[model samples]
Target: MYGARLQRSTCTNCNAAYTRRYLKVQRRVTPAVALHSRARQRAARRGLPFDLDVSDVIVPSICPALGVPLVVGEMRSPYSPSLDCIRPALGYVRGNTRVISDQANHLKGVLDIEGLIKRAVASVDQRREDYARLAAYLDRELLLADVRRKAALAGAAGEEWAEVAKFLDAAFVRADWKR
Candidate 1:
């Protein structure tokens, strides 16, 4: 009975020590790699495809959506790497899943593609209105300049001469300033 107890104690302690050593080694990896490894393990357990290697794709350390450097941390933290699903409620497929910054992932969660499109279209419309106003102003200025030039060339009097002289002075001044 004593021999059997001793043997069991040695075996269990060795096994526990080995498990602890393995976990310690895993903990030494970077947070981004560790999180990705955990996701791959989960995908394997769920019978999903996860063939991509994190080392191959994440060399630059930049977030794809935000276009900034990656800050390794746990899930849902700003600048931290997080796994994103291309289509909501779908299993993790090889091509459909990607790692992105947590901030971008959270932003995407609140706004669908359609909502983003609507916002972009509205912004473009407002910009177009501003551009229309600018173009109208330029057109009127060009017409006035042309009239002044014509009147000056035809030897017209005081106000027309002054207008043409001012316009020419402005044009020459701008040209000199560029140089």
Candidate 2:
């Protein structure tokens, strides 16, 4: 029933004396207004300084952090635009505030630039170690396979040589020849 308020109006003309009921349209909450309000409330709750107005909150079409299309009025959506404090300690000041995706804001989670960089570097190092270990395992397996192949070939050659020697000995006995 929001924005459904009715107002009674009377005609000013002398000929008409009838009162008409008109619906008063309520103002829709724009992205800027919503962001400013939410940020103000959060700052108030956290006892942080807030100096942002509705005009100060500029919502971009795409989130600067994630490059995803920002949606308004979708509070629970990850793509919903959120007003983030670049420096939490600085509060919701004009220069400290930015409009980013809710997902990015949540992922950031109070992390400073240095903390984020440290985490990223650690993750990269872990992945590199995992890849190196996998490569070493594969190399060892290939080397073992090569050795097994060579051993089989050598075994086969030895068996063939024994058969040839036996055949020669039998031919020599049949011809009554001594070696």
Candidate 3:
């Protein structure tokens, strides 16, 4: 039984020590290796911390978005707007060409807007100046003449304004002289 027998490790749990041990492994002399074991040993081997071609292992795309904000022509309409539209509104600012005009046709609009405004304001001043007038008229504060006067004064077109007042005042004085 001891011939061709070999020493071996025993069960660790049993605390069994080998002293001419009970377990035995038979050793044989063979001239060649088996085809299966030889092929396995020759197989492609890899070491620890081996690198894998995980590029195709599942990755996301890194390309940018679809398209950029390619802006086109943002120009105004081809047709031009009308002149009347550009002109100022009528009633606003009473833009009448008053206090300056021609004589033949006198094509001037009498609405010396500012002068008219001045007169209107003067009417108010007359009211306030005379307490009796305010009471006599009924019940209302006298109007502001300064506002109308200033408006009338504005009738003069800057440099031409002073001259225009002289011309109009002359006309009024002449009319008064008839009396």
Candidate 4:
């Protein structure tokens, strides 16, 4: 007669159970990873050909435009890697895309090198105009004060100084200020 029903579990069964649990845990993806996957899927659905895998995309720690650190989020942060096409119409081709911040992408705006240079030159010209205007104003104000002082000194002196003052007034006239 069987004494007590012998109860035993095989090492193989226990090991298989442990392996399945571990594999299941490992398969779980983080939100960032999920977002990236969704992006790829969306791109594919749009009929655009994307050869690069999500694993290959490197998320930068900093926003290149704003010069601030990037935080992981569903919409903008994870999706912040705005794929830039160097040629502007390359259509998501590999090697043409570089990751940049959304703000940078917006600022870049149409990506015509000539247009960008023209904008930069215009900005520089405006700054120079402002600086020149201020300099001219200061120069005129200071020179006018100096000219008034010289006139007062000439008026207080004698006839001999009157000839000197005449010369001084001529010089002031040449300087383009009131004597």
Model number with the top TM-score = 2
Worst window of 10 by summed lDDT in candidate 4: 1-10
Sort the predicted structures by lDDT, highest score first.
2, 1, 4, 3
lDDT of residue 101 for candidate 1: 63
lDDT for each residue of candidate 4 in 15-87, tens digit (9 for 90 to 100): 6666655443432424335435554675677676566665545555554333334454434543255544434
Candidate 4 clashing pairs, residues 3+ apart or interchain: none
Decide which is better by lDDT, 3 or 4: 4
How do all the candidates rank in terms of TM-score, highest first? 2, 1, 4, 3
The C-alpha stretches of model 1 lying farther than 4 A from their native spots are 1-28, 41-59, 73-76, 110-112, 118-179
Tell me the number of clashing residue pairs for each predicted model: 0, 0, 7, 0
| Candidate 3 runs further than 4 Å off | 1-156, 176-179
Pick the winner on lDDT between candidates 2 and 4: 2
TM-score list, all predictions = 0.40, 0.53, 0.14, 0.39
Report every candidate's CA lDDT.
0.51, 0.56, 0.23, 0.45
Indicate the TM-score of model 2: 0.53
Candidate 2 regions with alpha-carbon error over 4 angstroms: 4-29, 122-179
Q: C-alpha displacement of 69 in model 1, angstroms?
A: 1.9
Best by lDDT: 2
lDDT of 2 by residue, 30-91 (tens): 66775687678898999999998787777776655545677775445888888877667878
Q: Model 4 segments beyond 4 Å from truth?
A: 1-48, 64-66, 74-79, 122-179
Question: Model 4, residue 95: what's the lDDT?
Answer: 40
**lDDT minimum window of 10 residues, candidate 2:** 18-27
The digit string of per-residue lDDT tens for model 3 on 1-179 reads 33332433344433343422222111011101121122223322312121222221111111001011211122212111101100112211111111110110021122223433444455554322332221221111011222233446543544365555455434322322110
